[model samples]
Structures are given as C-alpha cells and as structure tokens.
Target chain A: MSGQTVANLMRGHIEALAARGERTDGRGANEFRDVSIETGLIGTAEGSARVTLGETTVMCGVKLLAGTPYPDSPGRGSMTTTAELACLASEQFEPGPPREPAIELARVVDRGIRESQMIDFEGLCIEHGEKVWVVFIDMHILDYGGNLFDCCTLAAASALAHAKIPNVQHGIADKDVDLPISCWPISCTFAKLGETIVLDPNHDEEMVMSARLTVAHDENGNLRAMQKGYNGAFTVDEIKTAVKTARTADKVLRKALKEATK
Target chain B: MAGGNSDIKFIKKGKRLDGRKPDELRKVRIEVGVLNRADGSCYLEWGNNKVYAGVFGPIECHPRHKQQQDRAIVQARYTMAPFSVNDRKRPGYDRRSSEISYIISQALERVVMVEQFPRAAIRVDMQVVEAHAGTRCAALTAASVALADAGIPMRDIIPSCAAGKVSDTVVLDLNKEEDNYGQADLPLAIVPSTGEVVLLQLDGHLTPDEFEQAFDMAYKGCMDIYEIQRAALADRYGGSA
Candidate 1:
C-alpha cells in the first residue's frame, strides 16, 4: 500500500479510538482476548506450534541446518524467519515474490527474537567461523485476523521451547557431542486503542487500533525485547502501562510455556 | 504386514497386526474446520496416517478456456507438506503427489454437482500431513468431508479405503509396513448410497477370487470410514452427513 493512504486510514482510526476511551471491540484497557495455544499438534517438524491471536492463525516450525556462523559471532548460532502471505489467506497477498509487506513482517518478527537473544547463539557454534547450527524458523499465516507480529512471536517462541534438537553425529577427528539449547524466549503484544491498551488484538481491532506494542519476555519475567507499531507517538504513561500489563501477562505466559513443554 | 521392523508393526501373533482379526481397520478419527482460513477444511487420522484437506472455490474460473457454460469444473490438487513425511518432502509437484492428485480429482469429479456452479471451478487442496498407509484413500475420504463441511453441493460423498494381501491373507486397512511389503494392494473409492466405485487402483499379484475378497474387505473399510465422515459433517452446519 502507498504511504499516503496507510497513514491517512491509520491516523483517522487513532483519533476516533482516543476520543472514545474504549476499544471498538468492547475490550478493557488491559484485558487480552481469550488466547489458546496448542503445541506438538503437527506430527512433522522438530518442534511445531499453532497460535490463534483472536482470529489470526499462525503456525511455526523449527528446522535445523548446518552452516557457518557469522565472522563476528562465530561461537554462536543464528535464527532466520520467513513469512508467507499465502493466496489462501487474503486476496491482497499476491502469490509469487515476497512482497514488501511480507519482508517487513519477517523482519519485525526476526528483530524480536534476534534482539532478545532468544537462543544461545554461541552454543550453536560447531567450529568457530566454520560449521555451526542454523535454526530456521518458518512462520505461516493461515488466517489474517491482524497483529501478526505478536501472533508470529507467540507461535515461534512456543515452537522453539518445544523444539528438540536431534542427537548430533559428526566427525571432528573422533570427537562428537550433542548440542543443547538452554532457553527459548517468548514474545507477547499489546495494542494502544484510544485510552485503552489491549492484549492480543483481533483482525477487526487491528484495522481500527491506533498503535500496537510487542514485548518479548523470558521464563523469569525478564524483558528481552520491545517494539511498537503504526509509527505513532505514545505518552510515557501509555508505555508504562504496556510494560506493567505485559509483565503481569508474563507470569501466565510462562505457565503456558511450561505446560506446552509437555 | 512384516515380521521385523519399526516401533509400530502391522502383523503380530501369526495374524494381521493392531489386533484386527485379519479384516480389521485402524482406528479412525475425523475433525472438521481444522483450518480456519479455508471455506471448508477437515483433518483425519486413519491410524498413523494423518491428512488435512481444504476446499476453496466454486467462485471464478481463471485462464478463461477452463470455464464452462453448463457446469463447473473440479480442479483438485493433492500435496504432501514438506514436513509431512518422515523424510522431508520438497514442496510442489512430485510423481507420487501427481498420481494421487489425478486419482483424487477423478474420484471427486464423479460426485460434485458441477452443474450448480456453471462457469466457475471448485478447487480442493488435499494435504497429507503424515503418511503411514492408505494415504490416498484417507486423503480422498477426508477431502469429501471437507467439501461437505464447506457446504458444497455433491451428488454423493466419496469414501475410499485400501484392502491388501499380507502373508497370503487379505487384510483390511493396510498400515505403513503392509503397504510397502504386502503382496497386493487394492485402493477403492465408493459412493455408499449408490454403491458405485469411482476410484480403483490395484498393484501387486492377486487371483480373481483374491481380488473379489480384497474388494469386499475394502468396501467394509470404506463403510467404517463413512461413519466418521458422516459424524464430522454433522457436527458442523448441522445435517445428516
């Protein structure tokens, strides 16, 4: 979409929601929609997760590959994200080349995991600057209910946590070792709709939302990363509320992660 | 069924395995609306083999020439997901997928009421998420349920099942091992109400009587699957499947 139309449409919704003091979907300031996650559902993939953020459906799969680590981070592993805006989802998403919108979505999701230090990149190093562990995280959008950044994060993180690296068999001059992953970071999103900040915005809500925020947290309620959407300015008060609400949700999210491990 | 193999065996105790008295089927389960995006979608687990199907159009026929004035054309493609099998299957077309797609499309075309849509096309995408045995039959059966779930009109529901020969004895619903090493396999797709076969594929050696026996076994297996198909359709949109 062109910059002018996107800005105009979003700016108008921002003003309307702000003046109303409530969400168009009737959600409270901090209440998240009922979010249910199911893991280990797909028989394929080392680890798989399906997350439905309201109506937006996202599925993530983690595939391991042998590769050389970057020159600087030779001792660490890496993660790559790919998003497909399938023709089945919406007509606006054309088949063929990955459009700018898809690239942006992948980058946004990649930033949350990369910046947060989700994986122990160093541990993935097989031989410094040589052979290393490459974690390929593929994100698929089954439905477009909106808030893909948060939904993809939730799905990717859960799939990572549930992922099991196969027992490695290699020849480093008679030395073989099994790779281990210590932690998986989880990402959750918050949206500022008018005066109200909601968790897990639905598709319609996303269309009408003023600004959306996403934060990645670890099992210990530690902040790993943060991002905001819509290029809107938020007051310090709104930012504080988002952090507080996310931290609270972090506890439940952690529990959800643990239960998902089973 | 083979004697020495993997975690799950198809034969045990000098008889067809999974505790079926030679002519038994694997446990079958079906669920509709498995995929929220597709107009109609369903998932099925016929024992270890799992398949998912979605029906998308009947909307518009593209490429112009494919359109018809009197009836809609059924365009179906059956694909296996990359991670669907034990060894990753590359996305897109393959010999096995193409063959299955042809058979599934032919089977579906027999029952779908194409006249209703006129110049449009009803596209059914069947994905085998996991493959054990009887994948084609399972895919065909699940696709009909998905089509029904999507509320597309059909002359009749197409149900399919495979009956094969193992250790000189015909067994119903061959599992993964039975499919690979069995003597003969006959996969059949039938319309229960009409009692007419729309899909018929046979591989391996079987005498005339043996073929008759296998066909009967497969027919019973189709009926077994039909119950689940009916139940799944009934759960969504409300009606007798």
Candidate 2:
C-alpha cells in the first residue's frame, strides 16, 4: 500500500480504539507512559539529564559560561535554549541546521522554564552589568518514540535543577555553587485522536493524531506555558480538559524530577 | 593528572594509565535497531564514548542535481553533542565534524554497493553523545553495522580501530588522557575479508618502525571489532547470516 493509505488505515484504527476509551499501547486516555530521568549523565556540562518517556529519549545539558549580560536584562543571567532533532533519532529528521520542528521544540521548552522563573537569574550575576553567567541548555533528541515536547521540557528542567555554577573555572568565585532553582515546572503533552484526546502519544499515535497540546505547570499548579501544535483545532471543552489532564500528569513528573535531581 | 603533561604518567610498569596493557582494546558494547523511526540504527558504547548511528535511504535523491546516474550517493554526517566532551561544543556543524563526516562517507562508500540503486541517496547519520577518544572510529564502526542492519548490500562490513603511541609505546586503543598527550595517533578502517584499508588518518609523530607496528595493531583491533559486528548482526537475525 501507499504510505498515505497505510497512515489512513492506522488513523482509522486509532480512532476506533480511542472511541472505546483505549490507546494502541493499551493505556487509558489520561495515562502517561513510563518516565525515567537520570541527572548528571554528561560530565562535561555543568549539569545534564537524560529523560526517557516510554521509548523516546532526550538528553539535556546545561553549560554555564561567563559573558556580558544583555543590555535589557543587565543584572540577571541569560539562558539560551536549543534543540537538535538529528537524523540519528529518526529517518524523517534530515541532517541540516535547526528546522521548524526543532525550533518549535526548543521554544516550547524554553517558555516553560523561563516563564515559570524556575532559575533565579539575578543570583547568577558575577558583576553588576559587566559579567554574568550565561546558561546554554541543549536538548538532543536521541530517540524519537514520541511526545518530544514534554520529554524535552522535563529533561531541560531536570538538567537545570542539577546545574551548578562553575565559579572557580570562570574565576568568579573560589568554589562552585548550585544553580538557584525557585520552582519546578513540568510539561505534559496530549494528542487528539478523532474526538478523544490521548495523553503522551507514542510515535504512531503522533503520526496519526489530529492536534497536539502541551501544558506546563509549576509546583504550585499554576499554568506557566501552553503550546498548540499541528493544523488541527480543539474545542473549548477539549482545551479545558487538556489543562486539567496536564495538571494531574505533572504531579507524577514533578515527583520523578525531584527524585532524579536529588 | 594535573600540572605538566610530562608529570602525568601515561604508562607505568607494563600497564597504561587505565590499568590496561599497551595492546588492549577497551570494552565495546553494541545494540542494533535501537530507534524505531530510523530504517536501521545502532547504539554503541566503546569505553566512555557513546555513539549512535542511523541509516536512511536508497530513497529517491533530493535536489535532482545531486543524484548520480550510475550509482547512489552516500552522505554521512558526524555530529558531537554539546556535552559529549570535556568542554561543551557549540551546536552546529564545525570544521572537525565536516572532515570526519567526509572521511566516514568515503570509507562506507567503498564497501556499499551503491551502483545498483542509480539516482538514489543513502544517508548515514552518526551522533556522538559521549566522547572519550577515538570517536570517529566508533562512529564508523557503528555506521557500518547500521547500514547492514538496514539490509543494504555491501562487499563487507567495515570495522575501524585506532592505535597511538603513548609513553613511547604504541598502544592498541588510546583513551581520553592518552589521546590528549599521545605522541602519535593512527585511526584506520578495514574490510576484514579483503584486507583493504578503506580509511586511514594520522596525526602526531611516529618513526617508520613505530608506524608499521601501530598499523599492525590497528588492523588486529579491527579484526577483533569485525567479530563483534558479526555477532551483533547474528544476534539480531537469529544467527542466520
């Protein structure tokens, strides 16, 4: 069969399964896949974490360097997020500069961490406006099982939590210090299959899903970031339900993140 | 471990710094078909280096001009993650990666029977998630297995290994510290059956006698690696091949 025909068949199969309140992986609509997070896996980086959401795996590394702070945020440290969806992760990802999917993944993960104020940026300043710590968060997609947004965000947040300022290396201080983390923000992703929204869609489910929604919540249950993906639209009721699902899902993730970082 | 290079003893007595003999190769572990989305993939951990290789293709070539009328084009891209080394590498392709990618493509192309698929393209992507030393050899070895796992026809599975001179002794495989302070480095890829040297790269300094010894050591290392490659494939295919 042609590729599209096979996709259509899979889509039909998924919709049929969804209507029965089940997923292809035999999980409930609100259930998430197994998540395992390991922190400090990359020795070179100040902090790093490897997250596995089911079969999908992503590695996030935090590299801190001393540089001139931005003029707009002079007293605060700066953070730049970048995501690479290398061809090694999947055949669909080509070898080139960052593409749309990668850029989108980075931005969504960035928004969750930055908007949540998870890192105490002001404390990172070495000198009033001259020199400050700049943190680079790099998200590398090693395996594309699915639900990359949530996985990337989790990896980034965990890595940030594990990060320490390389003060001695940068000649800013006599010893290293832990990054000031104020809050933990966890993201949950869901895909709409026909009329049903499934939490943490795997690769096949993502390929056939109509729309994607990712919701990030902080420790206090405040929604910090939201992203709507794909060309499909969701009903107002579906949006409300997604937020509720995300809030509940983040509880498990936050606990896992804490354990991993600790 | 600190101060001057000469102060750091790369070799002591009969063993190297990591407590291995000069001709010892690091422990290697290979797992094939690790990625579900790729046509074929392999995850390799050699010493402290973690590398993944994925093969995609024999598909129609993009940008028509890049296609060859008589043979498929093999394009290999080698990338190191930002946190792969002691210092974080900036994201994006750099001169070193470009050179390694080119050399890897040339090496794989020699063994892959590309002429059968005209106007097509085969892409091999090698990502180094962790690096100690000899990443190029590990990447090439993994890529060759990934190609075979993808069911691509080839003259033979290519295995690569590196030997370098440290503390005036030619070692079979150099680790991170040895690579940093080693006198000479020689990385080579060979077709075990045909004994053809497809890839050869050298750096540092070596006497003619030392060069021959290193070459012999590297070849032996490759032959050892070739057996592991075959076992990996057999494990995946139930020993049919």
Candidate 3:
C-alpha cells in the first residue's frame, strides 16, 4: 500500500478511538504525558535545561554576551531566539534554513517570554547608549513526538530562569549575578481530533489532529501568548474552555520549572 | 519587542480613538472578480489595510512527487509589498510570511473540496498592498472570496476578524493604534454556518475573563464580516437584494 493509504487507515483508527473518549496511551483528555525537566545539564553554558514530554525531548541553552545595544533601545538589553530542527530529531525535519515549523516554534516561545515582561532588560545594561548584555536562547530538538512548542518553551524558560550572568568574565564586575527573571510563563498545548480535545498530544494524536492550540499563561494566570495551528477549526466555546484549562495547567508546569531550577 | 507606549490613550468616554464604540468594526469594503486573467480574484480594504487575493488552477501538480493520488493539494502564498508598512519590508518570503502562508493554506484546505480533484493543485496568492495590522485575517478572508469567485465548491465561506484589550478593556475589530497599544489581541476566523473557528491566534497579556470577552467580541465581529462577504458574492452572482 502507498503511504497515503497507511496514513488514511491510521487516521481512521485514531478518529474512531477519539470519538469514544479514548487514546492509545490510555491517558485522560486533560492529562499530559510524563514530563521531566533537568537543568544545568551543560557545564560550559551559562545555563541549560533538558525537557522530555512523553517521547519529545528538547535541550535549551542560554548564553549571555556583552555587545553594543541597538540604536533605538540603548537603555535596554535584547534577546535573540533560534531553534534547530534537524534530521537527527525527526525524518520530517530537513537540513536547511529554519523551516516554517521551526521558525514558528521559536517565535511563539519568544513571545511568551517577551510579553510576560519576565526578563529585566534594563538590569542587563552596563552603560546607556553603549554596551549591554545580549541574551541568546538556543533550542535543539533531540526527539520528536508532538507538542514541541510546550517542550521548547519549558526548556527555554527553565534555562533562562536559572541562568547566571557572567559579570566577572565580561569585566563589568567582579561577581556574577543571577539572570533577572520576574515570573515564569508556562504554555499548554491541545489537539483536536474529531469532536474531542486532548492536552499535550503525543505523536499519534498530533499526526491525526485537525487543529492545534497552544495557550501560554504566566504565574498569575495572565494569558501571555497563543498560537493555533494546522488545518482545522474550533467553536468559540472550545477556545474559552481551553483558556480556563490553561489557567489550571499553569500551576503544574510552573512547579516543574521551579523544581528543576532548585 | 517591549510593550507600546502607555501614554497614548486608545479608549476614552466609552469611545475609541476613531470616535467609534468598542464593539464597532472599522469601515470595510470588498470587491470580487477584480483580476481578468485569474480564475478568481478579490480586493479588500479595511481601515488602512489593502489586500488582494487571486486563485488559479486545480491544474496538474508541479514537480510530480508532491501530487497525492487521492486528493488535490492547496498551496497558499502570503506576501507583503515592500511599501506596505511604515517601514519598508524586505522583499520575498521571510519566517513570518512563511508561517502565515502555512496556516492560511491549512485553513483553505479545510474548506476547499480538494478530494474532488485528484492529482491536482490549487494555488491561492495573497498580497498585502498596505498593512496597518490584521493583515493575515484580511488576506485569508479575501482569499476565501476569491476561491468562491473562481467557482470552487466549498464546505463554507470563512470570515476573519480580531478582538483585543486596549486600555484594559476588550474591544472588537481593533484598529492599528489599538492593536499596537492594546494589552492583548486575538485574531480569529470562523465558519459562520457551523460556528467553527478555522484560525485563531492571541498575544500579549489578558486574564481568563478578558480572554473570554475578547473571544466573544471577535466571534461576533466574524459574523458581521460574514454578512458582508455574502452580500459581495450575491452582488456578483445577481442573487436576491
């Protein structure tokens, strides 16, 4: 049989099971797969984290470097976010300029952090109109299941939250100071198959999902960023319900980030 | 990057900067069948934003390998003119345009009856001649009308709009200033018949209650846009007044 035939068959099976409120892994609709976060994994980097959500694994490294500030925002520091999705992570990813999926992943993760107002960009400034610390968050995907947005966000936030600014190395000061973070932003992803919506969808669920929504919220239950993906539609009620669920899920993910940092 | 200027007031005395109510949408006008050579075409003007959409093919799939045996693939390319915004945008595809193109393609594929045309491809091109915010929603809404003008069968026409929090209040169909200075923005597209959302994206800060209010506002805005779309198509097809 052709690849299309196989995909069609799998989609049919998944939809049938979804209609009955069941998943292949026997997880509940609101349940997330086993989540684990390990921080300070890379010794050379200022800070690093590895997060595994079900079968998906992503590693994030945060590096701080002193550089000239942008012309417009001399008093504040800046951040550059980049993601690498290579063939090693999944067959679907190719070796080229970052594709749409990788780009989207990086941007969504960046928005949550930037919009949350968590990072104190002003504190990173060494001198107005001159030098400032530029924070770079790099995410590398090691495994592919589903829900890379949440994994990447989790890893990036954890790595940033625990990162130390190398003040001594940059010659700004003799002692290193912790990266200034005011809050933690947590993102929860949901997939819609048939009429059912499930949180933290696995590889199979992602493959068959008609639509995908990722909602990010801060510790105070403030909605920070959201992105809806794939070829699908949802009712207005469905989105409202997702927002309510995201508020509840924020606590669990925030706890994970805190525990990993500790 | 950082939040916009807080000094600029977007709402005062229950009216917006444009002297409109919070629930009112910006002035909108859409023209269908604008292109002579294309199978279908549409031009849309919403506030200061100007967008054009053209549809072509159900033709033979290119490169051969991408063609599916069972169904046609829908390809949508969203691009912005260099002079569209306040700053000159770099020409050609960028990360932002690529992502927007992808989501628009997905939403179009859902409505277009692609399975009816085997081993073929439908190309939809959207160009933002001017942008003042909400260009993606405008482009997608225009493309749907262009598809209809091309005589393509669809499950339903999709209408798109945005609702956002400006001055800590949820308002419908935010204009450029409101979008930039607002606390949050939610762009949504819905199939009016089924009340199903085809596209949704949100950014900035909002509480759970604020999100609900914005969602409701945007949903109603989409319904209003739907009526306009139907009327535009009816005007072209000589339907009932």
Candidate 4:
C-alpha cells in the first residue's frame, strides 16, 4: 500500500478505538504516558533539564547573558526561546530554518512562561536600562515520540527552576543566586481522536488526531496560556473539560518537576 | 582559541585539573540504538560532554545532481545545541558548523561501503547536547557507532580522540580548560583495523618532536576508545562482550 493509504487505514483504526475511550497503547482517554525529568544534566549551561514524556524526549537549557536591555523593557529582563526540531529526532523533521511547527512550539512554550510571570524580571536587572540578564531558553528535541509541547514546557520550567545567575562569572556578586523563579507553569496537551479527547498523544496518535489543544496552568490552578492546533475544532464542552483536566495534570507534572530538581 | 593564558597553573604535581594522568582519557560511556526513530543511533558521554548520533538511509539521494552514479554518499551534520556551550549559540548553520559537517561527511564516506547502494545517500546526524571539549572527536566516534548500529557495512569503525600540549606537556583527551589555555591541540580519527588516519586537525603550536608525541598519545587514546565502541555495538546486537 502507499504511505498515505497506510496512514489512512491507521487513522481509521485509531479513531475507531478512541471512540470507545481506548488508546492503541492501552491508555485511558484521560491518561498520560510516563513522564520523567532529570535536571542539571548539562554542566556547560547555567541550568539544564531533560524531560521524557513517554518516548518523546526534550532537553532544555537556560543560559544567562548580561546585555543592554530593550528600550521598551529597560527595567525588566528579557527572554528568547527557540526550539530545534533536528532531523535526528525524527526523519519527518527536515533540516533548515525553524519551520512552522518549530516556530509555533517555541512561541507557545514562551507564552506559557511569560504569561505566567514565572521569572522575576526585575531580579535580572543589573542596572536600570543599562544592563540586564537575558535568559535564553533553547529546547532540543532528542526523541520525537509526540507531545512535544508538554515535554518542552516541562524541560524549560525545570531548567529555569534549576538555573543560577552567574554572579561570580559576571563579576556582579561574590556568589551566584537562583534564577528567581516565581511560579511553575505546567502545560497539558490533549488530542481529539474521533469524539474522545485523549491526554498526551504519542507520535502514532498525533499522526491520526484531528485536533490538538495545549493548556498551561500555574500552581493556583489559574489558566496561564493555551493554544489550539490543527484544522480541527473542539466543542465548547470539550474546551471546558480540557481546562479541568489540565488542573490535575499540572499538579502531577509540577510535583514531578519539584522532585527532579530537589 | 587554543593558546596564551599564562597565569593559572594547568598542571600541578604532574596532574591535570581534573586529576587525570598525562595519557589518561576522561571517563567515557557509549550506548547504541538509543533513539527510536532513526535506523541506528548512539549516545555518548565523555567526561561531561554528551552527544547523540543517528544514522538514516541508504535511501535515494535528494536533489538528483548530487548523486554519485557509482556509490552512495555520506551526508553528516554536526550541530551543537544552543545551550551546549557556556554561552548560547545561535541555532542553524554557521560557517564553522558547515566546515565540520563537510569534514565529517568526507571521513565517513571513506569507511561506509557506499558502492553497495549506488546513487543513494546515508545521512548521519550528530548532535552535541552538552559539550565540554573535544566534541568533534566525540561526535565522530558516536557517528561511527551509529552507522554500525544501522547495519551499514564498513571496512572498520573509526575511533577518534584528541591530544594536546598543556603546560608544555603532551596530554591525551584535552578537557575544556586544556583546550582553551593549552599551547596546542591535535584531534585525530583513524580506521582502527588499518591504522589509517582519516581525520586530523591541529591548532596552536607544536614542535616536530612534540607533534609526534602528541600523535602517538592520540593514537593510543583512539585504540582505547575503539574497544569501547566495539563493546557498545556488541552490547546492542546481543553479541558476546
């Protein structure tokens, strides 16, 4: 059979199974795959974490540089987020510029952290308008099982939580300080397969899912950011259900992040 | 930037900063077939440096004009994660990375049995997730294992390592400080079975005698790494240790 034909057959099979609240991997409609986070793995970077959600693995590193602040945000620090979907992670990801998916991924993750006010921007200021710490969050997709959004978010949050300001290295102080994390925003992603919404879609499910939604929430259960993806639409009730599910997922994921860093 | 820091003592009591002897290599661990999506993959950790290499294809070559009528071509890409270094590196292709990729592709082409898959291309992706020093050597070594894991036939696995002059002494497997402040650095990769050196690059300064000594040290380091590479492949294929 042709590649598309095989994909169509698989998609039909997956949707059929999903309609019964079942996943091909035997997961429930609201179940997540195993999530593991390891922090401080990269000694070269100020802070780093590797997060694996099921088989999809992403490594995030936080590097801080002292530079002139943007004119608009002279008193506040800045952040630049970028994601590399290298072909090494999967054959589907081609080499070249940051294509649509990668750009979207980075921006979505950045929105979660920024909107949540996770970092204390004022703490990063060295001198008002003159110099401030710029945090660089670089996410590397090492293995592409699926659910890159949640994996990248978890890795970035964990790495930032684990980061330390390079005070001594920058001659700003005698010792380094923590990156001044004010909150932990964990993201939960769901895929719409047939009429059922499943949490944490794997690569195979991702290939077949009609729509995807990622919702991020902070510790207080307040929604911080969200992104709806693909050409499929979600019902009003489905969006509400996703938000509720995100609350529970945030608790579990945030606990994992805390344990890994501690 | 491989020379000219005079203040700090790189050698103390004949021991390097990390306490390795002159010829001792940093601790290394290699695992094959680590990534699921690729045909073959390898993850390597040398000291604190971490790298992943994956091999795909003996498939059709793209952009028809690049095809070799007689044999497959090796397309190797070497990339460092932005956070792989102390300072963040801009993502995407830079001149340095392009050069490294070209050199690595040429080196792999020499070993891969390309004639078997005419007009095809073998893609090798080497990612330095975390780097200390000697990443090029680490990347080359990991790529060789990844190719083998892909079940690609080759004359031999290439073993790569570096030797350098720090504190006026030839040392094997230079670390970050050594590479930055040392007098010379010589990275070498060879086809272990034939001892044919396929890759060699140098920076800084070394006299003829020091150069020969560094080369010998690097060759020995490669031999040691070769054993580890063989063990990794065997471990993956369930062969005898």
* Local accuracy of candidate 2 as per-residue lDDT tens digits, B14-126: 99989999999999999999876678899999998889998888877776899999999888999999878756788999999999999999999899999999998898999
Which residue pairs of candidate 2 clash? none
Count of clashes, each model? 5, 0, 1, 0
Tens digits of per-residue lDDT for model 3, A191-259: 898888888888777877899999999888889999999989988999999989888866767788888
Best by TM-score: 4
lDDT of 4: 0.90
**Candidate 4 docking quality: incorrect, acceptable, medium or high:** medium
Comparing 2 and 4 on DockQ, the stronger one: 4
From the highest DockQ down, the ranking of the candidates is 4, 2, 1, 3
Give stretches of model 4 more than 4 Å off.
A1-6, B6-9
TM-score for each prediction? 0.77, 0.92, 0.52, 0.95
Question: All candidates: CA RMSD in angstroms?
Answer: 5.6, 2.8, 21.5, 1.9
- Regions of candidate 2 where Cα sits further than 4 Å from its true position: A1-5, A171-174, B1-9, B235-237
lDDT of 1 by residue, B94-192 (tens): 788778888788788889988888998777777665678788898899889888877899987888999988777778888777777777889999999
Clashing pairs in 1: A75-A122, A76-A121, A76-A122, A77-A121, A145-A203
Model 2 residue A54 lDDT score: 89
Q: Which 10 consecutive residues of model 4 chain A have the lowest summed lDDT? A: A1-10
TM-score of chain A of each: 0.80, 0.97, 0.95, 0.96
Error of 3 at A109 (Å): 0.3
